[model samples]
Target: MNTTNLIATIALLACATGVFSHEKSPHHAPKAAPMKEQKEWGIAGDVKDVRRTIAIRMTDDMRFTPSAITVHEGETVRLRAQNKGKVLHEIVIGTQAELAQHAEMMKKFPAMEHDEPYMAHVRAGGQGDVVWHFNRPGSFDFACLIPGHYQAGMTGTITVLPRKP
Candidate 1:
């Protein structure tokens, strides 16, 4: 092939790979900042470090079973989400302001893909989990930012009580 043809062929191949990318791969445009930075909500925890498991159910009624949860500071808990609804649902742990902002963004980009340690996208009739460490003392927010989900009141609160001195 000529030089130009060779370059064009390579470009086409690259585009084809992008089009058929794997689901777990990060392909969402305009991605968010790296999740490694610790937020006020706390950082991701290792599964082996998780001491407690909280079972949560996501229903089509735009609700999370046991929407309110409490954990002590310095504790690592496993958040297990089972999607009982016939639609996709996700749980993202963040500050109230962060959740609000993300929900607004999701409304604009309904197909935006996110795979952070603090978030879990559970499919209908499927289950997912997020292990998180509560090192901060305060209330945080978790919501399904799937366009109308958050507006329909699919949100929850996580209260991390301060550790007793």
Candidate 2:
């Protein structure tokens, strides 16, 4: 083969064997197995395991209607967020300290993008859901960590009651 053709063939072979591939390339990423992270409140739950769903409303006034929710231990609930205002809103579930820390971080980085199973971002007139299993019985906090939103009292509480004997 000519010199140019030989070089092209070698390049193709190198690429096929990943000799010139970037180790951090997205295509080379390992398959995403389901996350098994167990937070203080609970772990991520599958949709099929959802035993109940609670509808929450978000308005421009930075409030979540029926701000307090109750659930039993070992129950998987789908927390559905409905945004009725003319802006974006989100629900992030975590311990009180975690929520406060995250909200402060968001104030510094307004455009930060964090996608966790415990968070659901909903656009105006749209809806989102977070399926979570409450295995730990405790009172957790949920909030909208969108810059000034959380400071405006855009928060709620989730109470996990102990299961009946």
Highest lDDT: give the candidate number.
2
What TM-score does candidate 2 get on C-alpha atoms?
A: 0.81
Off by over 4 Å in 1: 1-35
lDDT tens per residue, model 2, 20-103: 466656677665766779999999999999979999999999999979999999999999999999999999999888888778
**Measured by TM-score, how close is model 1 to the native structure?**
0.79
Which parts of model 2 have CA positions greater than 4 angstroms off?
Answer: 1-34
Q: Residue 13: error of model 2 in Å?
A: 34
Output the lDDT of residue 100, model 2: 89
Which residue pairs overlap in candidate 2's backbone?
none
Task: Report, for all candidates in order, the number of backbone clashes.
Answer: 0, 0
- Against the true structure, candidate 1 has what lDDT? 0.87
How well is each residue in 1-165 modelled by candidate 1, as lDDT tens digits?
Answer: 567546645865676577578445776566565556587889888789988999999999999999999999999999999999999999999987888877876775577667788999999999999989989999898999999999999999999999999
Give the distance in Å from residue 107's predicted Cα in candidate 2 to where it truly belongs.
0.9
Of candidate 2, the 10-residue stretch with the lowest lDDT total is 15-24
